[model samples]
Each structure stands twice: as structure tokens, then as C-alpha cells.
Target: MNMPLELCEARDPKGLYKLARAGKIKGFTGIDDPYEPPINCEIELKQDNGICPTPTLMAGKVVTYLEDKGFLEC
Candidate 1:
């Protein structure tokens, strides 16, 4: 008897559709969609700090600010 070395996994289409609808997973190419705000406040505040801030500097500033505000994990 001979067996195939590679097996193709089959996904349940209905389960996938349900998960997408419930927003459990992101579907890059989906039929129905929910609308999120154009800007998230935290990220927007971080980006708006400077137009040409170096990534390292920006990261440091964000870390410092979050630390001062008691938001940083460590």
C-alpha cells in the first residue's frame, strides 16, 4: 500500500464565514465589514508628536511617557 507524503488540509467554509462575521479574525478579502474609526487616539497621539522623529527617539519618548503615566509593564 502506498500513502501520500503530503496531505491537503480542508477548512470548513461555514465556520470561517462565522468567525469573520463575529470579528474573531480579520479577513483581508471579505464581503461584509465593520467600520473602525480612522484614527486610534493612542497611536495618533504617538504619530502626531513629530513628522520626522527618528524611530529610536520616538520609541524612547513613547516609553518614557507611558512610564510616567504608569502604563509601561517595566
Candidate 2:
């Protein structure tokens, strides 16, 4: 459901609006409704860079966490 703005603008608003009215697509963000909730109103960011541990490390942590929670087979 996430799409870059350039792709959305390329379709032309008038055409996209017509498509929405015709029900060609459902839940079109930035067109049918507000794409995201108010900034900083509902969610909080812990870091500005948004960099977390590497993917492999993250995956390992997830597997470990799931195992600890009794959700993973191994």
C-alpha cells in the first residue's frame, strides 16, 4: 500500500479521482484518504538516523525472541 509520490503524481489527479469513483482501486493512500496519521501525534521515533542493527543480527534477535516466547520451532 506504500508508494512513492512520483508514481502517484504520474497518474494525474483527475484520472485517479475518476478511478476512485469507479472503484477500480480501494484504499488508495494520498487520494481516497489521508495517507498517514498526524506527525508525532500517535507515534514516536527513538532515533533520528533510524539505523538499527544489521539485518542478519536483527533476524537472529527476532528468532531468539520468538523462541523465548515459545512461538518458534527452534
Candidate 3:
């Protein structure tokens, strides 16, 4: 899953980002620590046109990829 930092921050359901921003949390992934996206990933789910696709759509994409690559037999 690859979402923008701002979107992730906005959707901070656990408020970890807030705590990380306030220095309460240390070594946070994106707040303090670096977040380097994978250079070569098999699949990447991201937002399109500033709108995130539903979970069903995202899972469909992954399933399709897997089937194409012969990872899923069914």
C-alpha cells in the first residue's frame, strides 16, 4: 500500500503520527525515521486522482497480479 504522507497523516486513526510529531514517539517511520519506498516491488496499491480505491478494487488488483504471475492457482 502506497499512500501520500499527507493522506496517511490525515488518516492517523491511532494518533501515532500526532504523538510522533509531538516528540512523544521516537523513531517513527515517516515522522522521524526515513520512509524509503521500494525500488522494485511486485505490486503497489496507490490512490488515483486523489481518491483512494475501495478495498475490493485494491484486492482485485492484487489477485489479478498474482494470478497473472501464477502465484494463485485458484
Candidate 4:
């Protein structure tokens, strides 16, 4: 739970979270169903001071690792 549900509500008073909570939405992540994260990931980027890393940067890091490890060449 990066930001708690209460915090989400606080951030967006008219968010769809209320509908999700009321079970009006089906198969919502972290609500009616558990979120299944990827396993055996090659790279896991840690948040920098609560700031998220850009997806492009993360992908570049993974590509660099793969290239260094001879898993990929491009």
C-alpha cells in the first residue's frame, strides 16, 4: 500500500475508490483481489525519497544490465 486508501480518499474526494469499496467494481486491484507482482525480476527500482523513477530510466537500466550480462545485445 504505497499510499493508504484513506490518503487516496483525502487526495481525491470524488475518486472511484468509493465505488470500488462498495463492491460496485469487480476485480479491482488491491480491493476485491490481491495484486500479483512480478517475481524473479531482473531489476527492481527503489523509490527515491518517495519519488517514482521514470519507466524509461528503469527500462534503460534493465537493458544495460542485460547487455552487460550478455543476455541481450543491441
Candidate 5:
């Protein structure tokens, strides 16, 4: 990704969108690259509340998925 041409520009957490809007960065995934969301991913997590699941919590999700599939016992 190219440096923001406007040095004084404010940056979001991941400046990809901003840089893309300014046409500064090329070959940026989801901006210039072709991206297709997975239709049948095993695990999908949403972060709209900005609450990232801790590793322990994430492990529990995986364990639950596996248990539901009769892959293991608690």
C-alpha cells in the first residue's frame, strides 16, 4: 500500500478504505483485488459490538462446534 499522499490525512484503524478512496494504494485486497466472501465458512464471527472474543471464548466456540458434530467429548 502506498503512503497516504496527503500527509495530514486522518487514518482509520486499517487505512485501506481511506487509501483506496484517495486512489493512493493499488493492489490492495478488497479495494483493487477481486474478493469473494466465503459462502460456507465453518466459523464466522461478527464484531459489530467491537467485542472481540478472547482466545478462551473462541476455543469454546470451536469446542462447541466440534461437540455438536460428535467429534469429541467435553
Candidate 6:
């Protein structure tokens, strides 16, 4: 998934980002360390209008991508 750093920090449910920012955690991604995005991926999930898709919807997207690529074929 390709989400912005601001969004991730804003929606931080574990408060890890907050901790990282406060120097409580070391080498945290997007804080002290860099976050490298995938160079090449089969399916890239991104936010739509700054809104993340639900888990069910994200799963459906994965299934659809697999089906389109014939990965689900038996």
C-alpha cells in the first residue's frame, strides 16, 4: 500500500509514530530511518481521496488482481 507519511502518522493506532517522534523508539521507519517504496509490484494499493479502503475491499482487490493474472487458476 502506498500511503503518505502524514496519513500514517495521523492514523497511527499504536502510537508508535508518536513514540518514534519523541525519541522513545530508535530507527523507526519514516522517522529516523527512510521508508523505501516498492520499485516494482504486481498490485499497488493506494488511498482514494485520502481514505483507505476497508479490509474486505482491499481483499477483493487482491483477489481480482490474482484472478486477472490467472494466479488463482487451479
Q: In terms of lDDT, which candidate is strongest?
A: 3
Clashes of each: 0, 0, 0, 0, 0, 0
Each candidate's TM vs. the true structure? 0.32, 0.32, 0.81, 0.49, 0.45, 0.76
Task: Estimate, for each residue in 1-74, the C-alpha lDDT of model 2 and write its tens digit.
Answer: 13344554654657775676578877776666667855544223222253434447656766776788788785
Report the error of model 2 at residue 64, Å: 0.8
Q: Judging by TM-score, tell me the better candidate of 2 and 5.
A: 5
Order candidates by lDDT, high to low: 3, 6, 4, 5, 2, 1
Predicted structure 4, TM vs. truth: 0.49
Which candidate has the highest TM-score of all? 3
Span of ten consecutive residues with least summed lDDT in model 1: 1-10
Model 4 CA lDDT for position 73: 69
Give candidate 5's error at residue 23 in angstroms.
17
The reply for model 2, stretches above 4 Å from the true place, is 1-51
* lDDT digits (tens) for residues 1-74 of candidate 4: 23344545655566667788898988877678786767776666655676656668777877898899999967
Query: How does model 5 fare in lDDT?
Result: 0.61
What range of 10 consecutive residues in model 5 has the weakest lDDT sum? 1-10
Among all windows of ten consecutive residues in candidate 2, which has the lowest summed lDDT? 42-51
TM-score of 3: 0.81
**Residue-level error in angstroms, candidate 1, position 36:** 6.9
All candidates' lDDT scores? 0.48, 0.57, 0.93, 0.69, 0.61, 0.90
Model 3 ranges off by over 4 Å = none
Error of 5 at 35 (Å): 5.0
